[model samples]
Target: MAIQIGFETLVEDLPGPRWQALFARLWPGYRAWFLRSGAVARPSYLESRRALRQHMPELVPTWQRLVELAGGGDVEARFLSLWCPPPYIVGCSQAVWIDPAGKEEPALLRNYDFAPALLEGSWLATRWQGQRVAAMGDCIWGALDGQNEAGVAASLSFGGSTVSGTGFGIPLVLRYVLEIAQSTAEAVALLQRVPVSMPYSITVLDRRADWATVFVGPDRPAEVTRRKAVTNFQHRIEWPEHARATHAAERLERLQKQVDGPGTLEDAIGALLQPPLYQSAYLRGYGTLYGVAYRPASGRMELLWPGVRWPQTLATFAEGRRDIVYTPGAEAPPDPDDAALAQLLTESRS
Candidate 1:
């Protein structure tokens, strides 16, 4: 049998009925994952809120409104804060390319690789914190990747490490950066102060073609580098098994070679759709579901799947849905939420 994955687009300037419906749809599955390790394993609502205030004060008001919309439950608030939640990881690759053709602005490219069932698949355009932001949403409100109206785009790839500590999840951190930062330097500065539960490499690109990859983790300080092409590791491979399984070294080498030389944005997008970077290990929880190209300078972004392209802009975003059909039964990995996610998708279709 074929499994179909659904994606939806939602536009709201602030929290309201539309956002409430989204929470109603996604919270059940996310709640299962959040409590997988038991409620005690996660932080208390007070602790979670406190951490958010200390590290990202600007998000507090929006977080409060979203929590209220979710019925103001304790678990809902804690999970939405994304503070030191259960550990999870993804296999992804990202890069910054200043297309030589000049047909478009400098672009940020990303391939989000993970289990199909687990992807929240919500495309959102919102001005929650004053600045307009367009992003692929995860965990209800957190951003998996996104760009702001200021022409700043940011994407993240998991840093190859098995470490987890006292910090927020990367998704919300990405959301925070896109919410407030206006430049690559500003984004890097934002990453430096916030702790991340796991190591992640975030590539931030601005309209001026300025970009940098910041490596952040709860255990250490954030490190910024000029590397344009980033895969799932920093400095060295900390998780050999994951690195080998995800072909981390191979993917990084391939991306590095491509970005090091001059190329058009068209060629760069084509390169990501090819081998090593465009993964297909869906069964293993590391398949490339979609490739996205962000032209921050032009305020445009394109979502790619083989030949199909769905383009959107902050100024003109249409709410819709796209269902991707996939063959089921990949040797289900140990990802805790895969089973819950599968059920969620199944129910949504019915």
Candidate 2:
């Protein structure tokens, strides 16, 4: 059976009941994931919130609104909104290129691999007032990766560093870049300046086909490169433990080979969907959720699985074109309170 992925628009003024119900549906699993790290103490909530406000002050309002809608004042929720501690997520490959010949618009292909449990019952498209993004995270306000109407496509991969320090989560950074930056250059500037909690890489492509991959973390200044392919590792693998998990060096070599070879976009994408690059969804946690190709110049996007393709565009998306929900067997069932919560949410919508 195909998993269901919902598509909808999001706005700042969310109804209390609807937001509460969504939180109730998604929070249990998210909370479990948060607690598994055991990194933050109960009293650290205020500290985390202060850091987020001091660094990325723009998100404070968004966070407060979400807290209010989730029935107000949950410190864990607030801390999570600030940063996600590691065993950093793994298994993603991102590549971008601009044809000097201008034969084709700049395109980016990405495969987001993570624990299937985190992806289950997630929405692919979420729009908030000035920005629209596709994401697969439990946070109603963040994005794993997404593209905006301004022709900027942003994607992330684990940066292959085990170190943690005072920094922000990459998902919120992705959301912030897409919402505020209009060009690849602007996005790169923001990525370089933003303090990320973990080692992470963000590949950004713009309408002009200009692209850049930025490596960021709390401990170092961002390393910006114009390389066409970026996997998990940076210039060199700093964390030996994560080297194999990210497959950093191998995937980068493979992607570069495809880029150097003569072929169409189809050939490049086909290469990305195979072994080493495209991970299978086995009983294991690190599995490929989906593949996406974004052409920023045209605002054309496609989501792909083995036999499924869903096409979407910013100008025409009322809701997403197709919807699928993916719930792996390992995921817990809906909360017992969902029945009543769903009813209350519906009442509020009317």
Using TM-score as the measure, the top candidate is: 1
TM-score of 2: 0.81
- Highest lDDT among the candidates is held by which one? 1
User: lDDT value for candidate 1?
Assistant: 0.85
lDDT scores in order:
0.85, 0.67
lDDT, residue 279, candidate 2 = 62
lDDT of 2 by residue, 1-350 (tens): 34444534333233355455667777766565456545453326676677667766776766776777676656545545656443345568888855545587778888877655455434445454446655444355566667788889988988876567766767778878877778999998888877887788899999887889998887899988987888877888765434554456777888888776677788777877676676653234455677788888898877766556767776665444445444443433435544532332222101
Q: How many pairs collide in each candidate, listed in order?
A: 0, 6
Candidate 2 residue pairs in clash (backbone atoms < 3 Å): 3-324, 3-325, 4-324, 4-325, 5-324, 5-325
Which pairs clash in the backbone of model 1? none
The parts of candidate 1 lying over 4 Å away from their true place are 101-103, 327-350
lDDT tens digits, residue span 4-110, model 1: 68888889988899989989988888898888768998999999989999999999999999999999999999999999877668888998887555666788999
